[model samples]
Target: MSVSSHLLFFFSSLGAFNGLLLALFLLLKKDKQYTDNWLAILLILLSVRIGKSVAFYFTPTLDKSILQLGLTACLLIGPCILAYVAQSTLNNLTMKRLTITLSCFTIATVITGILFPYQDYLALWQYWIYRGSSYLWLISLVVASVMYARKNTYKLALSKQLLTQQPVVVLAGSWLIWTAYFTASYTSYIMGALSFSLVLYLTLLLALKSKWQEKASTTQSKYQNNKLSTEQTTRFSNLLNNLIETEQVYLDPQLTLPRLAKRMSATHTQLSQLLNDHYQMNFKQFINTQRITKAKESLKTYPEMPVEEVAERCGFSASSTFYSTFKQQTGMTPNQYRTTEI
Candidate 1:
């Protein structure tokens, strides 16, 4: 192989290898969540499919069964993407429903592979299964995008929303872009592998940058002798209370310090200072306090409601966080607090 071809092979194959390794790590992770498992499955499927593309682009005589496996991986990718989106955003997909849906698709793929056997049915596999799987990927991406927008209240313009640095949004957008590349006839077959490489590296860079910023923010003094005046402090205090109590912005699990500061027509630094000096807490603590208070009320008023539902209603994001925070604040578990009364 020429140096250029070797470079292309290296560039594309590196991502697939790294993706498989990452997927294995996620699978073996002790503290992984449902969404994490789905994400791991997604990485595995994408890596397999992309690896097939890289191999087939260089070697025309690749095994038929390998081709079939790659396409079957494509068939499974859509469902995995959809499941990840649903579990991450809505958190309402029951394990039973997920199992049934994936099982049906897996069974169908296995049966079709057995009967058609791409070695003999190359035309059918290339024309029908390939196109069908690509379209399924596209449709899944569109549906997942709609679901995310609806559930997450993504109201920004298309350009702005796509430009947002949120991980889930970025993942969906990257998949959509990859699907477009593969579905278009003009694009090279190897472009999908290249695209995955680019996406993976970009995601890693963004993640590292985010962590660095978080560490920098923590190490540096946020306010650094910044203090609000008495009158300014009083006015801001009332506004903050109204925003939390009357508007109940704390009910949004996606609410962040910067978002709340924007709602208050203040800068995050100013808001942070006020929260620290006046409330004796930081943004997360203050928000969790409000959420815990709301949870306490719900637990008392609705004894029959499931703890998970209560956690969701109270903006806890995850039941584990809710349980921990409830215990920390009230010196008891939510159930104990509920049953013990005042």
Candidate 2:
């Protein structure tokens, strides 16, 4: 009932609402689904956790139910982070067993929390132990994501564009900010305010950026507007298409926009505009399309070639990515598609 308590609740509610909207965007937005569904799940979990904090502070009776619900959501954070980062880096293992195990653990945890009082096993020491482990696990995922980005530099499309570190850093920063509230009790409300502010700012910023970047990128180049006339643009497009389709530039498996632009004697932005305007896709999507097209041809032309080889020859860094891209593009796995073709 204190003024400070009410303020923290209000701000936390704001953060929660922002997070919910973002999760909805990920679920239903028209961006054509570049991000994995796991990211949306992660955001939902996070929104619940943030909202739970507000409930915890507002409820004078200190409801164990609200606290336990947040704990349950928190438990899955590590696994989801690992799964998302792994998939983002082109290491898209289904990890079904791991998911099942985590699910069971979450269920068991919820049951235990309900059966026992929060004061019993969920003491200060126990809470810190779990929180510490969760932080470590998250840090490990961030490090692993960065390491994979480095090691698989050639795996540009999936490895680099899968997940950016901005969200991860924001996640870590929010954790530390919220954690500081407990350590520095005198500044609890202040830290809570700061945490909620960061969440709202970053969440809205991301949504706006996502919604507007296509438009922004469209006008980003003067060359795209009028530097090249229609005929010139057509010629460049033809040349670029010929270069990739006939010369097989995509076979390198690391054919980024910059590399393609260099080969075409055009700037990166120009190439981006060319693809965006001509193909209605970003550079990565365009490249992946070419790869998938090549994969389809290979499947029928060289029926004896292993699917793995076909994946590599088609410029996919991993067979998993190949199958996923192929399935996503054609609605069938490579083997299934091959069967239908032959």
CA RMSD of all predictions: 4.4, 6.9
Q: 119-157, model 2: which lDDT tens digit per residue?
A: 665674247634754574456456655754564554345
Note the Cα lDDT for every prediction shown: 0.80, 0.66
Query: Distance (Å) between predicted and true CA of 311, model 1?
Result: 4.5
Looking at model 1, the pairs that clash are: none
> Candidate 1's C-alpha lDDT?
0.80
Alpha carbon deviation, residue 305, candidate 1 (Å):
9.3
* Highest-TM-score candidate: 1
Worst 10 residues of 1 by lDDT: 154-163
What are the per-residue Cα lDDT tens digits for candidate 1 across 1-342?
Answer: 999999999998988999899889989989976577888888999999989989999998999999999999988888778777767555342534776788898898999899889999989899998888888887888787787777556334335324444536445545754665576578677888888887778777766876786567555546455678998799889999999889788877767886677667776787898999999999999999999999999998998988887887777667788899999999999999998984
